[model samples]
Target: MKTISIFTQKGGVTKTTSTINISGVLAELGYKVLVIDFDTQCHLSLGYDVDKETEYNVEEFLNSVEPIRYAERGKHQNVSVISGKLKLSTKSLKRDSLKKPLKKIEKDFDFCLIDCPPKPINDDLGFGEIAIFASDYIISPVDYDAFTLDGLTTLIITLDELQQREKLTAQYLGFFFAKVEENTKDFKEAYRELSESEISSLLFKSYVRKNAFIRTSINTGESAVFLKPFSPVSMDYRKLTDELLMKIKIDAK
Candidate 1:
C-alpha cells in the first residue's frame, strides 16, 4: 500500500478539503482509497458525513487495549474512512496512539491518505516526524499569500531535518495552491512571485480556483467530482490527481 499525508503547519489552507477531494478523485478513477482523518477537529470525517455514526474514531484505535478496526466501509462504493473525533485532541490522544493502528491500516488499503493536524500540534507531539517516517509521499497545500511561502520554507526545512535525523526516504510531492483567486491582483502577484522563485519547480502548475460549488459539495457530503465533474474546480482537482499519479509511478520505479 502507498501512503500519502496531506499536511501543513498553518491552518485554513484547505488541508482537509484537499484530502477529501483527492481521495474522491482517486476512488472515482477506480483505485481503492482510504482516508484517515488524523486531525482532532474531525473535519474530514464530517465532510463525508461520517462524523456522528462512526463507531471507531482514531482515538479508539489508539487507546483501545485490543486491536482496533476504525475504518467504516462506505455505503457508496470503493471509498472507506477512518473518522476522527474532537476528543482525540483533548489529551493529545491521537498523537500518542497512531503508530500501530496506522501500520495495520496500511496493510489493508491500496492507498492511504492521512489528513494531518496543523503544524503546532504536529510539532508539539512530533506527529509530523512519525507521519514523514510512514508516508511514501507528503502533499502540502499552500495558499496564495506571502506568509504561505514562509510556511512552505519551514516545511521543507522540517523534512530535511527529519531526513537527516531519521534517514527518512519519503518523496516530497511539493505544494498545491488552494482556494486561489487569480483574478485578484494580490493572488496574481503571489502566484507570480512564487513562480519566479527557487521553489518554482515544487509549485504545482495546476491550482485549485476558489469556487463556491466546491465548498457546497463538501458541505453536502458529496465530492466535487460527483456533484459537478465538469466544473473548473473539479477539472483542476483531476489535473492535480493526474500529476500525483505520475509522481507515484516515478517513485515506485
Candidate 2:
C-alpha cells in the first residue's frame, strides 16, 4: 500500500479536512483506503464518526503490542479508520515506531492516509516524526495568509533534517491551497509569490476553494465530497484528488 501523511507545521489549514475528503474520494473510486488519525485532538476520528464505537485507537497501534486491532470501518465502503485519542501525546514512542505496525497491514489497503498533528508533541521526535517515518509520501495543504511562507519553510527544513539524519523515505508529493479564497487580493498575491519561488514546481494545479459547506459537512459527520457532490466545494476536492492521483500514478482498482 502507498501510505501518505497529510502534514504541515501549522494548524487550522484544513489538514484533517483534506485527509477526510481525499479518503472519501479514493473510496468512491473503489480503492480500499485506511485512514489513521494521528493527531492528539482526534478530529479525523470524529470526522469519520468512528470516535466512540472503536475497540481500539491509534495508541495501541503505536505501542507495538500483541493482539492489537484498531482498524474501524468508516461510513464509506472500502474505507477503514484507526481512531486517535487525546492521551496519545503522552506516549514515549520511537520515531520509527509506527513503521512496523503499518507494514503488517500493507497489503490490506490500497492507500493509507495519516492525519498528522500540527506540530511535534512530547518531544522533537514525536507523533509527527513517527507519522513521516511510516509514510511513503507527504502532502501539505497550505492556506493563504502571512504565516504561510514561514510554515512551509519550517516544514521543508524539518524534512531536510530528517532526510539527512534519519534516512527519511517519504517522497514530497506537492502543496495545494486549502480553504482558498481565490477572489481575494491576498490570495492572488500569495499564490503568485509561491508560484515564482524556488519550490514553484511543487505547487499543485488544483486547490480547494473556501466554502461554508466544508465545515458544515465535517460537523455533520460527512465529507463534503459525498454530502454535496455537485457543489463547488465538492468539485474542487474531486479535481484536487484526481490531480494528486495522477501525480502519484495511482489508478482505481
Candidate 3:
C-alpha cells in the first residue's frame, strides 16, 4: 500500500477532516483504503463512527503484542480503519515504533491514510515523527494565516531532521489550504506569499473554502463527501482529491 500521512503541527487545521474526506473520495474511486487514527482525541475514529464498536485501536498495534485489526467496510465501501485511543497520548514511544506494526497491515490495502495527533499534546516529537517515518507520501493541510509559514517550516525541518537521524521514506505530495476564505484579501495575500516563496513548487491548486456543513456532516458519522456529495463542501473535497491524485501521478513520472 502507498501510505499517506495527513499531518501538521498547528491545531484546528483540517488534519482529521481532510484525512477522512480524502480517503472517502479514494474509496469512491474504487481504491482499497485503510485509515489509521493515530491521535489521542480519536476524532477520525469518531468521524468514521467506528469509535465504540471496533475491537482494535492504535494502542493495541503500537504495543506490538496484539495483532492489528480493522473496522471493516467503514463509512464507505473499500474503506476500512484502525481506530485511535486516548491511551496513545500518554504511552511512551520509540522513534520507529509504529513502522513495523503498520507494515503488517498496510500491504492489504491500496492506500493507507494516517490521521496524526497534534504536536503539543504528546511530547516534543509526539506520534508525528513515527507517523511521518512510516508514510510514503505526506499531505499537510495549511491554513490561510500568518502561522502557516511557521507551521510548514517546522514540518520541513522535522522531516529533514528525521531523514538525518532516522530513516524516513516519505516525500511531500504538496500542501493545500483548508477552511479557506477565498474573498478575503488576507487570505489572498497568504496564498500569494506562499506561492511566491522558496517552496512555492510544493503548493497545490485546491482551495477548500469555509463550509459549515463540513463539521455537521462529519459529526453525524459521515464524511462530507458521502453525506452530501453534491454540497459545496463535498465538491471542495473532490477538488482537493483530484489535485492530490494529479500530483501523485506527476510525482510518479
lDDT (10s digit) by residue, model 3, range 1-253: 8888898888879899999888878988889998888888888888878864446887777877565677875355788888888665634777678788877776688999899877832346578767887788988888877777787887777776666766677887778988888999988998888888988888987878899998797778777887788988789888888888888788778
Write down the lDDT of every candidate, Cα atoms only. Answer: 0.76, 0.83, 0.81
- What lDDT score goes with residue 50 in model 1? 85
> If scored against the real structure, what TM-score would every candidate get?
0.88, 0.91, 0.91
Deviation (Å) of 230 in candidate 2: 1.0
Per-residue CA lDDT of candidate 1, range 31-82, in tens?
8887777776778888888854456666676664465554544324767887
lDDT of 3 at 63: 77
**For model 1, the run of ten residues with the poorest summed lDDT:** 88-97
TM-score, model 2 to reference = 0.91
Clashing pairs in 1: none
Off by over 4 Å in 2: 52-54, 64-76, 120-123, 250-253
Please, what's the RMSD in Å of model 2?
A: 2.7
Best candidate according to TM-score: 2
Model 2 lDDT tens row, 44-107 = 8888777644558887877766675655444566778888887666357777788989998898
